[model samples]
Target: MARPSYLARRAGGRYFLQIRLGKRAAELFQLPLLRVSLRTSDFAEARRRLVDNLGWVLELIEAPDLEAIGTVFDVRLRAYVDRGSPADERLLAERCAFENEVRRYFTRAQERGYAYQKRFPEIPGRWVDFVDQNKAAESSITRLTARRSYEAGRREAREAFNEGWEPAPNKAPALRPETLDPIAMLDRLVQDAVGRRMAQLAPGNLAPVAAPTIVPAETGNPNEPAKSDGSTATTPDRMSILLQEFLRPAGRKRQHTMKGRGEAEAVVQFAIDFLGDPRIDELTEEKWKLLDDALPDIPNRDNIPREFSQTLFQRFKYAETHGWKDLVRVTTTTIQSRYWGGLYKFLDFVIEQKLYAGPRPKFVCIDPENLAPLPRDAFDDTELLQLLQQPLFTGCKNRLHVWQPGGYFVQSHIYWGFLICILTGMRPGEVGQLKCADIRTDGEFYYFDLRPFDARSGRVALKDLRNLKTNAAGRVIPIHPILIELGLLDRMQDLIDKKEERLFPEWEAYIRKDGTVRWSQPLSKSWQYVKKLLKLSRADLTLYSTRHLMADWLDNEAIAQRTRDRILGHANDVRGRYGRKGILDPEIAAKIEALEPAVIKQMRKMLLSAKNRADAGGLTVLKTY
Candidate 1:
């Protein structure tokens, strides 16, 4: 029984390692398809290597004796050899292909029960190895085929092949092209596209694509958006506050956000270095100078926009107006410099994020200490009567004639927005974002629903309203007469009747050129105009001051601490849901409305008649420590 083995054979004609097998090779016969001339290689090493190695091969194959033995001894080997075949490449290859052909021939031989084993040969090695290895292997088939002299005729074919030889060509070269500039080619393509598409549109082709125009790339397509190509572009004008502010969208992947941060920081760092604060001033000086110095040379891309800077300044002025001046007073040696520095950084952040423009804010704070030097005869009682005679604001366009009758358009409407702010104490953002639908007048109360607003660019660019400044900032405040007189009730009713969502329009203006709009002006202009007309100047008073005024007004009148806090968007200790929206209960409206108009009107009349109440001898708290 031959052992299992590795087998290889020629498909055409050749002698090759056919089956490597051993003494225990009977497993070959188990395979029904395996039928062969079970003969050995004429080469001695072929028998020893292949046959001797079958033990190792048997460990791998799961088949039992018959399949293994038949495959190794007969299905693979072809042992017919014409006497004197030489070993050569032509001989080896032809035989390699031929041996397998001969192996296949044996399947026919077995069925015929022929006394002969035949070989159709291509090269010499097959017949030679059959003679040599078989003699050494003494395989069972060799013993059988020997008595049959008819097989020797089949082995003579290989002797004809090695006698004729030829060589194959190995090397050849083809012509090729010279230059390849992939980037330059892409650039040219983009340029061609831009030139072709950028001509004036035919008609009705007016929609801003999500994409901004593509500028030619420095190397290729300038219009392509910035890629993380380790590149930089510089510009002289630094007005794009958002570019400077360089804020990335919140909650982006670290890799993406880091890239945005890098771009933002590049622009912002330039601005900061330009400010040169630390270098110009001594350490003792407000030391705003220290920021430029201390900031690491490398920073994430965070734009420090001008708008944010202006807001910080505005915030400071607001604080000063509200008796928080202790936070803003800047001085060379003021230990409070830290707060100012923070203010600067915060403003820088705001600018980069497009919160404000780059220019520092210029809004002034009113002095609580001085209100004197009034222009005499500015308005007599007779004038006051006429000013009062004008019925309070009605829902009129008034855009054409807001200054009608006495050019006191601002004065006429001052009481509208101003009084409400004083009564409600909502910040400007809250007030500006207001809408008519938000005001609620039900059974026995007035509720101002503070919702989202976006007056930037008059909502032409985009609608930018949101629910509240913060969850805590959202509140419903009970209204007083001022709210009613200001047309809030009518507006709310109009909205409800019409089923509209908006509460107010933060006013703006537009210009039409040739019956087509081209430009717009901020509507806050109208607000300012209204303030000027009233001649009622107060410290830190703006739309926001109303919220302050309301809080202080309530406080001065001895309103409960919990209630005052609730009115000012602060949490009320008496209630778990602190701040403005918590004050939404109808009960709060009843309480706010309960304030005597007589007291309010009296305070107003008295304050207006004089500059400093010291002349009227308003009491001052004397400190005698």
Candidate 2:
């Protein structure tokens, strides 16, 4: 009953280990045996130890062995690839963009299995399959020979699969994860469950881990043992709060400004809801796809349907405008391109803010071909004027309202406001903050310097400049001779003579509501009211429509480039001369003086033409989003 002496004998020119497995002969990995001498003292101890090691090797040859080896390799790859590996500091410290991409890869992997994975090129799941099969002894033999360890296992597996892609009938059920490292295997499963839980509970919110500083969470299951890895993950509520904090307004340069913090909040909220990994660094593409799918399902209750409805909604819109809309829309590209740029900006915010770690966001395919602009005649010639000429004093029923009978300029506040936008293209906030004092009429020349309204959030001061949408938006429009002929100049001068500093203050106020002081808001309700009369095509009409209409005329026909630039108070292609205090305002005024009634007449004529055209030209009404 004695086991044979240990010998790796070569009958042919090859290497082999004659494993003593209960009288069976298994020639593993094609290794040739060199010695099989049954000696006493020379090979006695080797024979004894070989039997002991054989027992150890038999224990490792358990079920699900390939998966166990594969998992370890994956962990090692993670460690090697992490940028923070050298410093040993990777606690979700990555940009949101990169994290989003990684999540997308994993989610896709789970859905379609390993064959569909599209991450880095080098790594493959099949390599893990090799080690998981518990054929390392064969692998070691292969290594000793000319081939690799895993290669031998793969070869054997392939041979077996060719016969039947399953274990023989009498074999044990797979040990799988437990065979390689049971505790670590279970840990991975638990993390995956946690990932699934957070994704389900709050889309983008990740529950926290109970680490050194944090108190342990009170669990739903008291009997469940504490995680073997010391740290516990986040809960949904805490993550949401953190995400909100991250999106809250910071300073003037923040993506969201006071005027449009609502949209900014919405963008950040979208990031949070999609990526559930509140660490921001943990966000990935899979989360965004999930969130993207979820967004359309959430009802939009605003005039701009996609824009969320809340006090904070405007802020988010305003913020988005700064980066997304304003920047892109100014270019002469298609509307879809502009919107794509807007999406790009939001995706960057996800990255910059680390809503997740990875690359730039992966967007679903949006057919840019679907986008089309409002017809040129949609807001052309007569329609704009007809919309504007309605009585200013009238209620919000139509395009124009009836004005109240009173003092010359005082009674004409609303009319004058629309007039200013038509002639000068000043925004609502600019008009709301304008002062009669700022208008200076010297001889035949008249000009007004617009300044941004200064506001504050708590103790933090906000910006003051030409409160136009962007830095490029600042311009000084000249008074038209037609405006002079219509007696609008005389009317404005009359208001100045009366010593009224502010042209309009009816809507502006500082309210002490419930002891908290707050500034009055801008004129959007009025814009919507105006939208009724201007019932230009729904897409073509907005508070900004007047500005767009006027600019087109001014730039194309009415004024020469130098004269237009001068009238608009822009420097004459001189950059360095601007910084000096001695730049003459008088020169700017003289330029504005050169502009005549030609611009006004051309604008009016264009409007008249547009009025005669058919309105059914574009799908402006349908594209509210």
Candidate 3:
């Protein structure tokens, strides 16, 4: 026995010409199989039909280009539809003709059988009985009530015959020399696979044709340049790889910080997961819409448990013990900033690299106006005093290791960090990342320099490299009288004596996977602990509230708009821009330092009361503070 082809199959006592595709082909076609009944039980007839079908299949597979294959299939379909004459009309006509033919066949059979019965009366009990039976069958076909049922059976038989029948050259559309192009046919096949439903073709019996491998136009080797015609002949780049390239740090000028890059990666990874990690070129509008629709459903990590797992076993154990908790839902503002923001940037990169064909995607969903406005959690003087007097600032044993245990003494860095932020309006990260060298004094005034460390300076270790959030964030702010009065300068001197670089060395530095250090995390945790201890946990205030409070205070004081903008690292207006260069002027510094005497008095009282309380309790305060 000869080997059977993958396309040949026998079902219900009939041979079928089935199109069975491999996994890759099925994915490309978006279909698992294309099966057509040959309408014949004879193996020879099935083989002949298969041979006829293979001719076109082989031609399509062997096409030199997609364009050629597309043209062929387009012409074939047009010609086939044309042969039937306007499809609906021709189909109706064919059905009526088939019904009439079935009626005639029944009529002939009745007449011939009845005539035979009459001629040989002795052959049956009665010729009249045979004639009556034949008349009854004929009436069933002719009757209006039975007409629909009769036509249905006739239509089915006609369809079966048509499936097995091959129309002659004149009756059917001919494959013109121009239309025989295999490339055109394959292109059409692809279009059908993507744009619409695929048509099933009848099976034929012919010599087995091996399944042809289909190479998509967008696929290509990464290292190799694409063909001049803009076709790639290999695998396309994975979305993950493309995303990495898009988010990769360019140079010092355009480089994204480790945290920024990580956030961008997270956004892009969400898109990749939503799109099933399709090739970069395969990111269609439809798939993108799915991601957009699914954004609202994606569980947020806002309130999820923060567990530390250093090993696979530890991770597994944590999951097993904790199980999965309900994730917090993200807000529209988060979607706008994190999701749409990152996606729009990536789209720009894709356009810049010419990675995709046709027009670039317009990120209409990234509307800033869509983001809901949130009220700033500014603290009043009383709340500020309460926050400062918390255990983290006074003398709580460092239960969470968030702060250094100074016995009964407060961690001076955490104490001063909050105080400085309240007075200077500096961000938590900015305060946490301060270095001893950043605190400098001119003959006239003392100030803190908020600037990125020089990359060439070997003295500044990799983990100690200072990175400002933005260009506008780098500025010098005059040291508040309260900070100086509270011995902040003295603390800097002590750190310098120890040769420590960071201002707050006790606050642990968190090294991210990208080898960059984050100094703000511990301070943020300490603030949270403080909030919880002070019974202010339900308050909307965060460490950031200090900056808001300072802004409110400065605004109420009727401070110069320019001075306030400069102090807060906000974008300056045109008037504020005039006559300003690097390093603030002495006059402006004086104006910033001149805070209300009442505020200073309140701060001093709060600090003193906390200290006296700890002393009265016989707690051994760290001698330095």
RMSD, candidate 3, Å: 36.4
- Candidate 3, superposed: residue stretches over 4 Å from native: 1-236, 244-259, 301-329, 365-373, 394-407, 452-466, 514-516, 537-539, 574-578, 597-599, 609-619, 623-625
The window of 10 residues in a row where model 2 has the poorest summed lDDT is: 616-625
Return the TM-score for each candidate structure.
0.35, 0.41, 0.53
lDDT of 3: 0.60
TM-score of model 3 relative to the true fold? 0.53
Best by TM-score: 3
Q: What are the runs in model 1 whose C-alpha is more than 4 Å off?
A: 1-245, 248-271, 275-398, 406-415, 451-467, 485-487, 497-499, 506-527, 530-543, 571-588, 597-625
lDDT score, candidate 3, position 454: 24
Write down the lDDT that model 2 would get. Answer: 0.43
Residue 147 shift from truth in candidate 1, angstroms? 80
Global lDDT scores for all candidate models: 0.41, 0.43, 0.60
Better of 1 and 2 by TM-score: 2
lDDT of 2 by residue, 1-625 (tens): 3536444434444222243433211222112321222212334453553453343234322213233323433454454354322221111211121222233334434444443223332333332232222234334433555545667888999999999788658867766553587788899999999998877788566556655433333322222234636544445333345544444555545464333333344445544434433554445577656544433222223333344335223333444444333212212232224323444555555556555457776545333332234543224656654564543422222222343222111233454566666676556556666666556554446656543321110012344344454443344455544445444555556656777567664545443311222222435565576566455456656666666665565565545665454334344565522321211255554544343345456655543332222123311111000
lDDT per residue (tens digit) for residues 1-625 in model 3: 5624734666458665556656654543345764444445666666765664555454443445333444444444344334432223223222232223223323433444433222332322222233333345445444644777889988988997789954355666765775487898899889978654323332442334445444443343344444534454334476767876765655555444335555566667767655656777777777777667655444444434455243222333344455536333456777777777777777766777688774555444432323353556888677776766566565656434424344465545666677788888998778877889899776678899775542111124444545666556767788887677666777889888988887877666777644556667856876787777667754467788888888887887788777788778887667765553345878777877886546567777777665666657755556332
| Candidate 1 lDDT | 0.41
Q: Summarize candidate 1's per-residue lDDT along 1-625 as a digit string, tens digits.
A: 3433444444443223334334343333322233222233434444444443344234423335323323333323343354324232223333333344434334434445432322322222343455454334334434545745555644454554567733467678775547888998899999988876765354665555453444442233342244334233332233233333344443433322222243234324433333422211122322334333322221111233333333333333244344432333322222123333334444455555454444643212223332233222222333334334332221122434534432222222233443455456665545545566566554567677553431110112212444354444645677776556534565566655766555543232243321222111233454466558776464343434345445555765677776666566664444636233223555555666777544467544543432133234442211111
Question: Which predicted model would earn the best lDDT?
Answer: 3
| Model 2 residue 522 distance off true place after TM-score fit, in angstroms | 7.4
